[model samples]
Target: MTRTSRRWAIAAAAFLAAPVLAGCAAGFDATTVKHYSPTEARATTVRGIQISQGFVLGPEPGGKLPKGGSAPVYLSLTNIEQQDDQLVGVAVNNAGTVKLAAPIVLPRDKRVSTSGAAAPGATPTAGTAGPPLVIEGLTKELAGGEYIAMSLQFANAGAVDLTLPVVARSREFATWAPAPAPTTQQTPTTGPTPAATATPVPTATATLTATEDASTGGH
Candidate 1:
């Protein structure tokens, strides 16, 4: 074969292989590439109510409560509608009975916090007063790194199920610990009953004196 013909033949072969190599590279890139985006760690929206940042404040060090004790849950509820709603009930599985101190009024276009600062007229002494929700009679001990399944029932928004994270009582959440159990004061017992006052009796001599005075008048 002529040398010029041989060079042209080799060039043609290289061009054909180049397209195949490019196709292989494109296929590999499509499968290997990964995309990532930022998202909320814990949040959920149901109906018009938005529930987010839900967490259960853990017990203090060495202060864990036994089964049948109570704990507190904190979360943010945002009402995105123009009308009002109420957080009337809560339920927890394997955690015991859940009770709301009061039904939380979810005003339209507002966010209510279960923790944080006390609302106006809210008693600061009862730590859970501001939150309105308290979980009493815990069936098991919950600590950091644990989670519980909770269901929140709203008057208008319906019910939302949440897997709430248990955060340790530390740093900013230190103050979010459950309030101490209320103590009942006992009344002092009286030592003994006082003796009843004795009724005064008229002396026999006074009665006789009166009788003699009456006889003298008659005489």
Candidate 2:
């Protein structure tokens, strides 16, 4: 074939393949349906203590967290001030008491978080940092996509009020641990067992015979 004819044939083949590739791409779209955002967690600045990425891990998808149960919370704290601070407690109205796995100490200009990583370039302290905060003894059942009012109590920073979202245990939070279910302790049944009734024993009577003496006399 002539060079001109060969070039035209190659162009025709390339033009024909373009529509097929486009159709394949259209059929299998690579766009994601869900996305992870830092804003999904609540963030607020209280005095010099900045709390970020705060959210309670709610029930599994389409499930309800039972009353008197517990839920786990994740949050990051940054101490922007010069002094250190301690997170002593957290309170949720009509929800539950916040339980800290360990004492959380926020060093000056450093970060500590329950999500493991404290900040962008900071590592959590070995023994004294990075403890999970949990809500125990929930007063009411909770579903996902709900909001609850919470208060964080600090040793020096005082208390900070927050409204945190209850994120479901699916998608980005699927890997995070949920709060342990409440265990029911069975109480021992008490009462004295009825004593077995005692039975009466009959006494046997002994009979004595004197006729043997008369036979001996006859002999």
Count of steric clashes across candidates, in order: 0, 0
* Global lDDT of each candidate: 0.68, 0.74
User: How would you encode candidate 1's per-residue C-alpha lDDT over 1-219 as one tens digit per residue?
Assistant: 999999999999999999677666765323122111111325888899887567776666445556676677777778897799988999998787876787778888777776546423232223444445667777777655467898899998888888876655655566664745756999999788899999889699999999999999999
Model 2 Cα lDDT, one tens digit per residue, 1-219: 999999999999999999777666653322122233445578788899987678888877778888888888777788888888888888888788888776678889876767654445544534532237788888888776667898888889899999887877887777766776556999999999999999865433222234556667889
- TM agreement with the true structure for every prediction: 0.61, 0.62
lDDT, model 2: 0.74
Q: State the TM-score for model 2.
A: 0.62
The deviation in Å at residue 86 for candidate 1 is: 1.1
Q: What is the TM-score of candidate 1?
A: 0.61
| Model 2 ranges off by over 4 Å | 1-36, 116-131, 183-219
**Looking at candidate 1, what is the lDDT of residue 92?**
91
lDDT of 1: 0.68
